[model samples]
Target: MYVQIDLDGPAGTLRVSGHGLPVVELVRAPGSPPDAHTPIGSRRRALLTLRVDGVPASIGPARGRLLRRSYRVDARVGGVRYRLMPCGYEHSALSRDGRRIGTLQSSGDGRVVDEWEGAPDPLDLVLGTALAAAFGTGAAPWWETVGDIVGELIP
Candidate 1:
């Protein structure tokens, strides 16, 4: 699947579109953590707002630390679970039940690339890109709310 992540904006909004999937827009939630304005905690945060095909949805981190050494965090959008793991050279794998269903890749000159394993949910790709962009900041940071997604849930 073809996905594009746009980060060139003050809002840090991420837009993903392509591959017959619904377009999704992700935005960081307030108090979610690691925002430049906040202090204390890791750069990895789990709260965000996702708009899939113009319908809004919420995604947030689940309690408990990740047991897998390769993965960074576990997040949920409704009942769906998403695991973000590190992959080959600047690439991240977004999986469900240990199966890689999506991926996020970053390149020089500030371009983000993404691909899906099959016909995965568009929101999965959206969440992957949001986390990728958030943690990609690579600077002193803290944990904050990120955001609480609300509105339509893509099926």
Candidate 2:
């Protein structure tokens, strides 16, 4: 599985490769204090749009859905890992502190997988997340809508 995580937008996109992947470990940050858990899930916030190999868009993924799961990871990397729940993200494959992570995309039924190259910047996590969201939508980010758009992409 592949995943990318942003601290500010608090958003990300991941593409998984197979079924029964160990996704639970991605949530929360690696080695985070147990008191800080994945924010209670919000369906409105978790709405993910998907496209298969450039197929038409779908609100719910065709193969599977990405779920957010909270977990603790190598503290040297970040201390905690708040990963997608049931599905996986690029963050899982990368060191928590690494910048060149990928995204993990899953189908609703958890069948297929796709991991796209990610572009996260070490300076601004929000900007990096917005960039990723734009990539997912195949649309350019409007200069004015950047903050709100970025905020909407993540929780």
Candidate 3:
């Protein structure tokens, strides 16, 4: 399943974090054939608690679920919104595999952050681009259409 999350932070905007502290978003699941590379532990649902720029936002599961090979999540916190989508794929299909959010192309490895350590982070730009693509393509929510000209740093 694809798991995506929008994180609130002092950065002044919505961003994604897998390891900044507190699993603002949890990324894990078991594999078929019981592979040890990935394992499943006792699992249950709990409120998703996060500190957005020091303020806290706890949310109940809203849209996405682990069951879908692909999923999308949109959340609001600290008055800002976050978007997340996770995709599960087979080995053979791994080549050239990526999910498009509007126009920001995300590599399947979930290593999207390091790509934006530089100013005007290309990844973030791409994310906005993805939103624009989706919105313009008429493939996603109408609100995302604003992404075409509006880009934010989440501050």
Candidate 4:
């Protein structure tokens, strides 16, 4: 399954989709605990906590400068402690055993992209993008659409 998260709009407004179907919507209001409904979350935080379907996955601050910064968030999901490292503008999800699980890519225009090798859970992708946004690296142009990038990558 393919998941896409758009964070190009106002802070706390995120649109999430699985393949071509709507899955959830996520919002992070200023000074309030981030809330997600309709499977919606992460379309938007300060030291944001990565929440998927109302569950916190990773906790970290979106620090450093663009292209030169890095996020070392602590992920506690599914009884697993994972590590997320920034790779350029994209981020990778690794198991505690250091195995590659999947990746969350970003367009210069501000859309969060998801790519993985196995049939990884969609929640993992959402969590990855949510963490990226939480750490403030989710930057994409306003006009880029998730549909536009679908089928563009043939891996």
**RMSD to truth, every model:** 12.3, 16.1, 16.3, 11.3
Q: On a 0 to 100 scale, what is the lDDT of residue 35 in model 2?
A: 22
Per-residue error for 60 in candidate 3, Å, reads: 5.0
TM-score between model 1 and native = 0.51
Candidate 4 achieves a global lDDT of: 0.48
**lDDT of model number 1:** 0.53
Error of 1 at 128 (Å): 3.7
Which of candidates 2 and 3 is the stronger one according to TM-score? 3
Question: Candidate 1 on 1-155: residue-level lDDT in tens?
Answer: 66665663334456666767667666665544444521112333444556667766544432322222323556555566667655544576777656788777654223556777876576676666655654431221112112212223333
The 0-to-1 C-alpha lDDT of every candidate, in the order given, reads 0.53, 0.27, 0.29, 0.48
Clash count list over all predictions: 13, 48, 19, 15
Show the lowest summed lDDT stretch of 10 residues, model 4.
Answer: 36-45
Off by over 4 Å in 4: 15-47, 65-69, 88-97, 108-110, 133-155
C-alpha lDDT (0 to 100) for residue 55 of candidate 1 = 68
User: TM-score for model 2?
Assistant: 0.21
Q: Which candidate number maximizes lDDT?
A: 1
lDDT of 1 at 7: 60
Q: Where's the lowest-lDDT run of ten residues in candidate 2?
A: 36-45
Candidate 2 Cα outliers beyond 4 Å, as residue runs: 1-95, 106-112, 116-140, 144-155
Sorted by lDDT, highest first, which candidate order results? 1, 4, 3, 2
Q: After superposition, how far is residue 152 of candidate 2 from its true place, in Å?
A: 18
